[model samples]
Target: MSQNERFDNNDSDSLILSFNGDANHEFQEINENLGIVRDVIRNLVPLGAIKVAEGIVIEPVVDYVFESCKRNPNMVFVTLYYARGLQEIDHHEGDSVGPALRDMRKKRIECSELLARELVHKFNDQDLLFTKVLTKRYAFSQYDEISNRKNALDLATRLYSEMGNCGAIFLSDNEVQACVYALWSGHLVPRISRTFPILAVIDYYIPNHNLNFLENFKNLELLNIPRNQYLLDVFSYIMFLIIYTMVAANYNEIRELNGFLEGSMYLLVFSFILNDIRTLQKHGIKEFLYFRRILSLILHVILATDFALRIKHVTSFDHSIPQFHRKALSLVPIFLYWRVLLTLEAFQPIGRWLTQISRILKKSMSYYILLALAFIAFFQSFLVLENTHKRHEGDDDHLGDKNEWGIFALLVKGILNAPDFPGASKLENRFGFVLYSVYVFTVSVILFAVLLPLFMTAFATRRSVPEEYLAHFAHIVIRKVKHNQPTRYNYPSPFNLLYFTLVLPISSLSIIIGHNHIRLYANIEKFLTRIIFFIPMIGFALIETHFVNDKQDKEARDLDLRELPGLPFPEDEKQMLRRILYGLNDIKEQHRSLHFRLEAIESQLA
Candidate 1:
């Protein structure tokens, strides 16, 4: 691979990351200069048992680490280091240390086996080691355009292999103040399950996170996500999908949606509310009880309450429901569909694009503020030109409006590229027509032509740093991979309802009465979860053991037709799997051919 062919760092002035004060970006960047980082680690670490990586030759580092271990087997000698690769010393400038590191960063397999064992696997939850490991993960983020999901798995594999619990991060025990674990897991693990059977690889399961991980995959075949996160999002997506299907199935007859479909949907809603309540309990009452959070909470309650009592609203209206009720129910699915797009962050390519779009939108906030000021200025100008006189009979304040469209709506439509000049011509306010003309010119000329380009330029700048987003993505996977928080929050949906109503309440009552009457909560919770979610839970349980025992299966693919096992799969599923492999191979060949053509063209042109 050449320098030009390496991953785009988005060199167009968009700073790579610079995430947050907590992210410690400068510390990560310093590690890129290998020599300085190694010396820093060496000074802090004891010599007899130090594992080092930095400016030194990549080959000797592992050997040196092995030698150090032999010298002191009991002690862990971890010294971070940097050096130019010795073997590349005689190579041309194009194949020097920089390019070599870039290549290694992409392939993420060859030199990485030793590096993964040395750096990431042995990592403890110290602040310094945490930063070092995170930076190395970022290096692992560099790959070709198609991407390699297996790259970050190497980091995740080592991480999960070594650590089984999430201890205090940076010596901070406070939950609110310390969101280190939340930050780590939320970014990476859920995403990695896309390609690998991340479910089977981990030794233990974190109940709540596992539930979330399974929720993302959709297919019941691969059920390995840990459970820990409550209803982190405001609306429950799976519930929404189920309810939306029910609503669609019984469209126009809202009263008919009241039977089993309604009951199932309500059950899901109740479970979601229960999860949200538990999440709320973790916070001080002041957090959401105050005016800011209180407002959203109040709105949430009203919406849920309205939907809950919806049966009463529909049952009274003969064969149909009120228009507003029907509209409200339908409007919700639109947002849920949008939520699915947000969840696509678990996929690398989609996640990167979404990240860029978010950055661009965020950067455009100043532009929005500017636009707000413009709107206010023009509206005030229109007010100054207001009149009591009517342009014609029946001409009201919204004479410029088309049907249900208000004056503001009409103006917005025009700005959005669908001008309503005929409607604006009917304005009854004094000088309203004149002001509308000026408004159109100002918005079209000054805003569209001028401000729009500035925003586009900012978009390009934000789009540059693909690596930062990848780091964020890998962090999400690594977080889940490392710690298996054996908390009792692993139940999913309706099953979660069982745990909350019976198991959780029973556990709480035991604590309150000092009776200890409840059976082991974790055991009971697991038993109930298995019974309720037997299809996914049992499937995961049976398959995961083989993966846990066989380390090679992590990267193994059964591509050999002759060696393929026939495991009594249905004929249809086998055919579907074959088609999937065929499609994948076809795409791979296209990419390979295009790459070759590009290389040939470049050689001839040069």
Candidate 2:
């Protein structure tokens, strides 16, 4: 029972609420996380890449070896494919899974994880591209046979490019895949990133969690616990706005009215900072950080710094710090608006929109990389062309002059559609002006070509099949919410810090204190939390439990979704809906009884 694992305070039944869709691990409960029929193909994809790479190198040598032989060579090359499944013999639904000839369908998981993340192709082995790859992949490169193209690192990179993030990310540490990342040259080298049987890794943190699925053949249920996310979001958002307003007001006017508002904002900001650290403790650094989280962290830091600056300035009366703080807070609006969107993401539609936006931002890193390259090229060229203006006579302050750092900033701004023509207005050299023109035009067109298609594909992703998008969006929201949930310090941020301040000191004291003392304050802390944050705790507590079981938060409480007069069900169709639901439940119970009786009869007959 770790802090982040949602402690049910109200003595409620620990339940798992499926969000937006239904999933059954009914067969998975019976089978020991054995591969589903659909997973075999995806699992073999990596194996296929390995086979192709081997054949590409070995078959050539094998053919040549036969050619050199005097007589007909008796050799056979065979590749066996095995995708074992036994739904009939093992799984719960096997009773109905008759007819070995029956054709089935693969679940539409929109498995982008299986897709290649990079370009993979046949290389000349001696290509300069393998230089770094080889050094990283092989330790005995010089001693190993140089002609053994069959073991080259080319295939590894190719497969990795295809497998992308699907490959063993950090699992390369087992001394297994670590030494294999040598090179792609005409040499015997091991594959750097091992072919992680992407399908066999059953506990791969799937979004639509399967409860009945477990390792060691145990029929255990792993829950994706539902909390009172609505109350949390609404309360947090309201608090966020209040804090934002204080920041917007420069922390002066708010203090004049009530010091608590200004003071509470600091606690909330600190609490958020604590939540992020707890998140990192729970989930290790991934391939990268989320854009929203990064921005939010930056925002928190700036606000925290501003709070510090306010305290220092009040005491010392320094004015310059305000300018620095203002400069940092200027970036807050961007982060703040994005934060608003993140808060709204508890709702399914908005959550999908946020996920899509995040995906677009994640995928468009190549555009940023290209932009950086262009900026470097253009900035250096400008400095070369008109870097040295006369100190006294010419425009010595020209941004392109030697030792000027403004050129770097100017170049970056130019790419962002805010072209700052330092040379256009005050250029002493014609070459400088010509270069600036070329830089602007070249960079703009390059961005247009690169970024337009990157986003065109975004719309296409959104237009994908409903079930696929639903599952994808469902998982994204679940992961995002889970990450934001606090772990270790069950107390949210500043509270966690404060909570530990007392507990930590008492535990370290020399005087022998028994468990009763800790138990006493543990109760006290919860009591204090209830008393202090009384309103939010109540809304959150009352909201988490629903005896009906299949409860959700956002839409039910949304004012916009509430039925208005003149609507299709003007007579309050919810009453009619409830009656319909009652009838459905009765029918469901009858069907269950009937199904059980039939099974009993069938078993007797068998």
The candidate that wins on TM-score is 2
Q: Report, for all candidates in order, the number of backbone clashes.
A: 35, 11
lDDT of 2 by residue, 1-606 (tens): 665445663223324433211223322221211122124324433321322322232323323323332111111000000111211222335446543322221111111111111111111122222232222222112333322222112232222223232122211211112112111000112122223322111111112212221220121111112233333544665677767686567645322323676677777777777767766767666512655577777788788787776676566656786666556656767777777676666455676676576567667778778877888887677565444444434566543344446567667767788876654435445666677778889889878877796678688767542223233333333343333323211444444566556644554552366544756655655455444444544333333222211222222322223324335433356346545755786899999999999999999999
Each prediction's TM-score versus the true structure: 0.50, 0.51
RMSD per candidate (Å) reads 20.3, 20.2
| Cα lDDT listed for each candidate | 0.43, 0.42
The clash tally of candidate 2 reads 11
- Model 2, C-alpha of 484: deviation from truth (Å): 10
